[model samples]
Target: MIRRTRHVPQIASSEITPETVWLNRRNLIKAAAAGTMATTLPTLASQTPDLKPLSYVPGECDGCAAEEALTPLEDATSYNNFYEFGTDKSDPAEYAHNMTIDPWSVEVSGLVNKPGKLNLEDVLSGFDLEERVYRFRCVEAWSMVVPWIGFPLADLLQRFEPTADARYVAFKTLYRPKEMRGTRSFTSVIDWPYREGLRLDEAMHPLTLMAVGLYGKTLPNQNGAPLRLVVPWKYGFKSIKSIVSIELTDQQPKTSWQELAAQEYGFFSNVNPEVDHPRWSQRYERRLPSSLFKPNRVPTQLFNGYADQVASLYTGMDLKKYY
Candidate 1:
């Protein structure tokens, strides 16, 4: 059954750490370790110097029915599928720290009028960031509710002025074999740079976001620090991370997974419980933070429970065929 509830409650302002306090997080951690501080904050120990407290308007869960529990920070950061770092779930958390993110830039080309290279600061400074509490569903049938800090992707794309010929938007992840161990690994199945795409309308959808951070802090290396894409209703793989280029194209770009295994991974990888994967059923999902004693499995909702907002986009189309 589909569950319906009011938007998730907003995070209290008191819970937000001030910019000064966040900047001095390391010192605070040291003080806590030395017993100089009366109250020791455990989360502070994981904070990196690059992470800054983002300024954003709190998000409302528009069509939600219940307050979804957020996955623990440790779980979210440690368990990931960034093939660039390694194939193992725990690999990204262990090796992603070796990559450099500060000198990052995104090259916007193809059908856009204002095609140029944009530095990380320029990308963030041009828009007003917002916080979105979204349900993140993976193609593997595991899920998590994440609080992401980002701006609408449409807002950024509009600035580039896509031409009339532009029908699709393509994204590419940064590829540095020297730093990204998986890229150099002989066992890797992916091409050099990971690629993903979306139809123009899908790219412009309000729910599509360019995430820079999570949990009120700048993103960790394993979590796609500096920049990443977040499309709430789609499977997690569609939201590619460590983006380095965005191209407006007329042809349907060949995505990484589709090229590797077309039957298993479709180009439009929407979350449809009715469409079972070739090897497994998609009828249910295991919510993260589950234990062997409490499996925490639940029926999977169509479009990951955003059907009211996005179902119209697929009207008169064959989801089973397209999927």
Candidate 2:
């Protein structure tokens, strides 16, 4: 029998239906905020210069047909995965304050007809913010809900006008190990200057976001300060942080995890409870800041519990092998 806890929702096992899997707007918002709170805020509190409580209101599920979708960011900036500037999560939060990001430029090239380094301000000024509540599953087996504010990747790509030749979108993270101490670690398993990608379709999905911030504050450096990708249904690794470049290409881009272990990290790293990690079960995850005396492990869900909105995207694909 499939065992479930109090927080886990019940589902019909007869078929994989999108209508049944999608979260309502209100619940989506709750999950997003909760997830962010669980993953980011603890670290943020330690590194945040002001130690101020950022502006945030309760979020609601947006017609997702699910109850209580929102989740808070546990530690806004103190996330433990700041590989963009360095490997340790706290390293970026501390070292990134010195980064002069105002004169930033992003190179958009490869299969695109128009290729050049674009000003960061110009790129940022062009979009509107949309609050998307999504389930976040970290590779280490923790999870949260995050109400991300950003526009769809497709909306941004439309402006660039990718040629039909474009089949992939590759993102490059900022590499400054001298300033970021985590990169200097000799025993680090992850490569410096992390990279990530998506099939053209995944990149263009309405749920995918090119995020600049969370919890209504400027994105803290440790949390992919300038720009990051948010692929809700996939594992957090798919969401590359602190991106400095975005290249549209005919061939698939090399990603950090896939490079480390192709068999373990697929190009599409969607979260599926049915498939267990090599050393752990993906069936459940621990929410950060969990009560010391109580149960902390939260159940994992299909499509990270956003299947209702994105299940169709992977209709006939074999998730077990790809995962």
Candidate 3:
């Protein structure tokens, strides 16, 4: 069942509502309490996840340009990926504006010498956020090119200075259920408080970004609010949202989907159309808003069409096995 806060607006409510909804003070307290408990788990302990101020330049393409022509971040961030709040892509946009960001920080722990919580400003002020045009391919069989403004994850990790023991980097999301109503439901396929990981090399890759904002504005709550990762060559899920904690460890980190199905989701989920998932074929994908009248679908590409820049990174290794 989808549990909503006790506070109800004058508008009608069924199982779901697309409009912005507010929760009662009592319900808000309960939600915050629940979120606090969720954070206690080792999985959710990040410093703080809040949107950092950023500037954006429209009509710029840096890394992946083929799909860059599709849509801009202003539309992309405001219009999609609201399933964390509800099934409606726009629900987070409506309900999440109320999200309290700032006073935010993320905890960097695990295999690092400097393992401590740092404020959002401390994190953002450390680097120059550059523009990168990367193709984002979702597991739902849809694709888009986004012009993201952020610095590389490797650059950030280098600042923290990881020990030799650091082998994989794990990331966690903020676990507030009241604001993220999707977690309050029983139907979600994702684990509560989503998590993701990358091997040390991948984490340090120039292509991996610890994004602060997009489209010349602070990232909207629906689009990760504070911090999210952007890995151009992998599936979108690998780029976890609402990052609160970054942990470096010697052991292979347990990513959310990989834990759900080891056989189906390899540690390195490289995009490969040749290797189809047992449940569905990865050979093709539907573009977003697959219009009822004119459904347009396109074939999936190996390495998400960034094979030139990233394929060599996995040289001599069987991507099928690592995938």
Per-residue accuracy of model 2 over 245-306 as CA lDDT, tens digit each: 88998998889889998877888888899888787788888766456686578888898888
CA lDDT of each prediction against the hidden true structure: 0.85, 0.70, 0.72
Which segments of candidate 2 are over 4 A away from where they belong? 1-74, 84-95
Candidate 1 achieves a global lDDT of: 0.85
Worst 10 residues of 1 by lDDT: 39-48
| Candidate topping lDDT | 1
Native-to-model Cα distance after best TM-score fit, residue 138 in candidate 1, in Å: 0.7
For every model shown, what is its TM-score relative to the native structure? 0.85, 0.77, 0.77
Best by TM-score: 1
Give the lDDT ranking, best first: 1, 3, 2
Error of 1 at 220 (Å): 1.0
List all candidate RMSDs to the true structure.
Answer: 13.0, 15.9, 10.1
lDDT of candidate 3 vs native? 0.72
Q: Write model 3 residue lDDT over 1-323, tens digit each, in one string.
A: 99888876665456453233232334335646767535322111111123345754432334534543655443465455645677775566555655566668788988887788878787667777676767788776777777667778887788788999899999988877876677788978878677889999888876788877765556667677677898878888898887889999898878878878888888788888987777888999776545677665778889888787688789999877788
Off by over 4 Å in 1: 1-47, 60-66
Candidate 2: lDDT of 122?
Answer: 63
Per-residue C-alpha lDDT of model 1 across residues 1-323, encoded as one tens digit per residue: 99887899789998998564588777777867878455322234233456788888776546432268888776787678999998888778767877789899999899999998889998777788888888888999999888888888998899899999999999999999999999999977898699999999999988888999898877887888789999888899999999999999999999999989999999898999999989999999999978899989988889998898889889998999999
Clashing residue pairs in candidate 3 are 46-107, 46-244, 46-245, 47-105, 47-106, 47-107, 48-105, 48-106, 50-226, 51-226
